[model samples]
Target: MIRLDTIKDIIVFLLAYIPPLLVFAKFWREKHKNIIVLIIITLIYLGGSIFTQNLLPFILIIFDIKFIKSAGTSYLDNKIDNTYNKTKFGRDINSVLKFDYNRFKFNGRNFSIFSALKLSAISYTVSLLISIVETILLSRLNVKLEGQEVVSWMSSMQLWRFIIIIPVMIIFAPVVEEFVFRWLFFEKIFKNRMGIYLSALISSLIFGFAHFNLRSFPILVWIGIFNCYLIDKKGYWYSVFNHFTFNFITTMALLIDKI
Candidate 1:
């Protein structure tokens, strides 16, 4: 049996259980209505999984974007001059981050190749720092890193798991996560005329909360805020490229350690 040996462990345990408790409370308060609602959702999901052969998620995403709602590039005008704007790296990166939309329309130019390279190098360096922090924290905790079991599975002869997880981490994660957190979420928060940093902080807190990793909360918030600012200024692809590079480096590191 696992023991909450320290105050940190107890706190972590409580934080982990809070979400589930709140969810249960919601249903518990109105069991009749909530249970029926839950059953309907479950039935629809079951039907979709059966009929669509697990393509329901894709179908839902398409429906959400096309019919339900889609995130726009809002709050781009709220950016103001700052100390970071005066920095060399910031100026250079922002220059490349600019997309020539008219050029894309006329000459088919999309994004600067140099920006992609810059994002890759920057992400690699940042990921290294994050990995170091993660190592120190994980060492102190009894709990495993999120998805740590995947490392052991990969080390074994789990070729099918390899086929599934590798692409999901490197490809799907970058696109989906960046869209949800940076694009969709940031727009939601910045709908009011407020300080950009406050909006970023709220969203970053939620991002960290969503991960269910108490130990990694600060790291996640830093990533969330950084990506928020990045996506705000640098645009979607730039942020996605950074996230992609970050995940790719992490996946590669885990693979090397396991194998």
Candidate 2:
């Protein structure tokens, strides 16, 4: 007989796929366009995974206009920027690259790198707290923490493999994920506050689900919320830094555990 906890796990697992399914359903009328986009993203991701062991960095470079015109500026950047400008949440994409924290002020003071780093630290701490809470909840529910395939794979990799992969995890992953999930998917697409919140929920849910770690889903979603807040307030790079710092710390922890 299936235990009650197993049934709960199954329900959660099925619910995790709901966002992507909704996305497909909403775009069913534009199925051809959606399919083409998905195919291109998948190919780029796979190529990076096969060759470099990192997908997001390659995707970011390929999508950057400075690197390649057709694949970068014409196809991805233009579409994302155009949509961004038309939305209420829109800001100049160029500003994101400029690192001008002065554009954002808090408590009558201009935002600085120090404050940004502080925010990143706070976000990381909050994510950890959320993870602890999630773990406790799962314990109470008698659900075994499942879905650690990525961690298992990482543990089995050689030193050289880690050296090659670490930079991608710290740098490329943050940049690419922020660009795709927060900038393009959330800010560029959503307009109102309600839309933004809904976008955050759905996008974060999808982000968590992508990791294939059901036990870490809530923690990932919390991180997603923190990232979305950064992008909405400051710009994409703020969230990128937050993401980078989080990944860097997590990667180090995993490395230490391996040792």
Candidate 3:
């Protein structure tokens, strides 16, 4: 069993969950541009996922730009400073995070790049191992006297399981999340070395919180940060494949759990 005491577990939960939730709630009510929203979401996410929280992870999981009703005015102060400036480029550049597909360049020369594959495999493997450790640790925690109801709620989702969610997780989530979090969010805010680390940390936290399960938050953050690194280093497709691999592995684990 995971030998953590009740107090220690609570401390971990609070550290990981509070910051991101504060950030998310801070900006959720405001009106901002897509770029701004993207930046704040990433920041808030980082804050929230630092500590594992039971209810907060679910909120983090489904929280994407599309699901957000509209952009609020809670503009990212730094991102806006960099993006909207008086230059020859009179209008904002939408091409940076091109939503349309034709703009996606599939350079034939880089078709069999080993670095990309290696990065994806290594990161995915690391996340899988981390998640396994977290699950085992969580299973050992003395079930919180007050958390049984919450666990029951989560258990209900197990009925449908991986078979129903793998496609959505691997394909749809990677496309949408990478576009919003990395292409849009990281591009604007993460300009310098400090910004890069901050962006990766925040993006990972948000990714972790989105999962809503305390036991899984650590793994999600690990995966999220790794994906952030891939995106920062190799661009969009790298992050996508890394994300797909992590989810695929998780889906397999979930399936195995059924047996």
Candidate 4:
């Protein structure tokens, strides 16, 4: 017999999946879209993650080989170049990755680390407030919402688990996500003025929905927009830095909470 708790869990899972599925489906149906490429990249990412988690370490131990860095760099470079060529921008991947400090100037002033920090602080503070308000509203309405996946995962992990995941989460995730969402989607796919704005909205909504957290959806969307704005104003590196800072802060907060 199916237990009541199992049924509740299934219901919650479906609720979380439905909205993102709908958004993704809409994007898929749109012509001239890169949905297929996104799907392929996602599959490769999952497969590589599984292999790294299960087999790669054992292989390295057995062979005493320490070439993971070069292999990983080659893999990432190929993937980025493939995606770049597929996009409308048609720019070289190296050029896309270049950092231009002159581009950082905003309204006759140059961008600085302090400016980025201030923006991140404001974004995080406002998003946290919104999340708190959302949770309270949902509770008042008798709606049961699940906690964010990252927070829940972190809460249940030990120090060793954190040590294993920190580089992947803080370093790799921000770079890959910014490249896919902000650089590819907003900059390459939607290169025009109106299209760029529309892309930002659509991409932000999709990014938020992709997280599968209703309570934190608005917060994620705000972060997405902030990242997109950074890409638009400064460059891809700026957005990557902002994303890395945000993730690093959140990771530290989670660790502190666990402690």
Candidate 5:
């Protein structure tokens, strides 16, 4: 029999995640026409999350590339130009903004792969260190990590299963998460009134809470902050690249352990 607490947890999760998406729809896009695309993507995310082990559905995200490119990339140029400087939307990138190789002409560049990897390394290392510290502290207190089950399941996946999830982990997941947390939540929803530091903090906390993992909450928040910093100083694609690279490294580590 299903327990009442389990049902309650499900209700709570739906309330937190579902309502936010509705509110997010209003604040997420510059144009109202794009809300349909946003709603579809969120539905895809929900379905994909429910079957995370069977990750092939995530490849469908590639089909959604039109959403990002059509919405975002028409205006970006190597030169910052008057428009790039004037608009917050131009400066910020959403999820799945392709890092076209032809970009980065002369002194002015759209996104820097090398710089992204460097910062992603820093963010990834910091997350690992924080997790290690948290684990030690929690162990002393005899508290079991609520998040460990998910990590353990991921790490223990069979080779074929792990291989199937690679694209989802590196590309689709990063794109979607960055779009939601960084672009929609941090920039559009909160950053206008909250300023950089506080907005980043609140959004990062929300990002962490969305994962429903108490032990890794701080790590997720720190990663969120790092992504916000990238979007602030670097560009939207920078944070997307950092997030993908971070996930790549983590997914590879898990793959190696499974092997």
Candidate 6:
């Protein structure tokens, strides 16, 4: 029998995402409109969320597969065939967003400690700036919410939770999250102004909701939107950097207080 923890997320992921992903992939190959596909994916995510299961991860895997296929196609067409690459949505984001396999190859940029630090710095700075701006805006709206408390408390450097947390924040979180939210979803979904706004909005909302912190949901939402903008404005690198840095710094801050 599967462990409760293992089976829970695994089953949820498969049931919530596999059908829609297959449908979307087949539809994409046919060069059809992806509205229905997106809708199906969205419902799967919503269902997964409501059920509090691992469905999101499963859906993400499907999306990841699609992204990999697109990337391979893009690389081959650009390098070998000279045909313009197409996104899963049948739109080309490559004219502006270039993915250098040499630079961003799996064993290349991302695996390097230097690159990770650089990414952490950029992502943290951007996230901090966006958080500041958002704080100001929400203040003007006369709404207040909880600040980082338990995280701060548990993060005390005296406790050593931070030492463990920092690496998790930096290395573990960035790779998967960036690949899914920024690289895969943003690359596939956001094509134009409307799509851009929607992508940021939807993706951000999902990002926040995923946290499961009801009190901080709004803030997370705003952060998600800002992160999406950063991804569009700068590149996936910026988002990856900001995300790692933000998490690392916050965890450190908490750790320091504990110390």
- The 0-to-1 C-alpha lDDT of every candidate, in the order given, reads 0.52, 0.61, 0.52, 0.59, 0.64, 0.55
Off by over 4 Å in 2: 1-50, 53-111, 192-194
For TM-score, the strongest prediction is: 5
For model 3, residues 141-190, the per-residue Cα lDDT tens digits are 84422322233443345647535555665665565556545644555445
If scored against the real structure, what TM-score would every candidate get?
A: 0.53, 0.63, 0.50, 0.60, 0.64, 0.50
Clash number by candidate, in order: 0, 0, 19, 0, 1, 10
Candidate 1 residues 1-259, lDDT tens each? 6653445434433433222223333333322346665566545754554443224333333333322111112112223562222233233222222232221121213556687678668655675688687777778875565643334455573555565677666765565566566655564335254567887888778767665565566666777787776676666666667777766776787666655
- How close to the true structure is residue 30 of candidate 3, measured as C-alpha lDDT? 32
lDDT per residue, candidate 4, 74-111, as tens digits? Answer: 33555653553333435432334333223422122454
Winner by lDDT: 5
Global Cα lDDT for candidate 4: 0.59
Candidate 2: tens digits of C-alpha lDDT, residues 1-259: 9996566545533433222333332233222257666667556654544455345443443334231122223224445544532324344333232222232221224446787799998987888898788888878999897656666677788977876778777987776677567755676555254587888887787677667677778878888888888878876668878888888887888898767
Q: What TM-score quantifies how close candidate 5 is to the native fold?
A: 0.64
Cα RMSD for predicted model 6? 9.4
**Lowest lDDT block of 10, candidate 2:** 99-108
* Residue pair clashes in candidate 5: 93-236
Runs of candidate 6 exceeding 4 Å displacement? 1-158, 190-194
Badly placed stretches (over 4 Å) of model 1 are 1-109, 130-157, 191-193, 257-259
User: Over the stretch 138-170, how does candidate 5's per-residue lDDT look in tens digits?
Assistant: 889998867644466687778897798688778
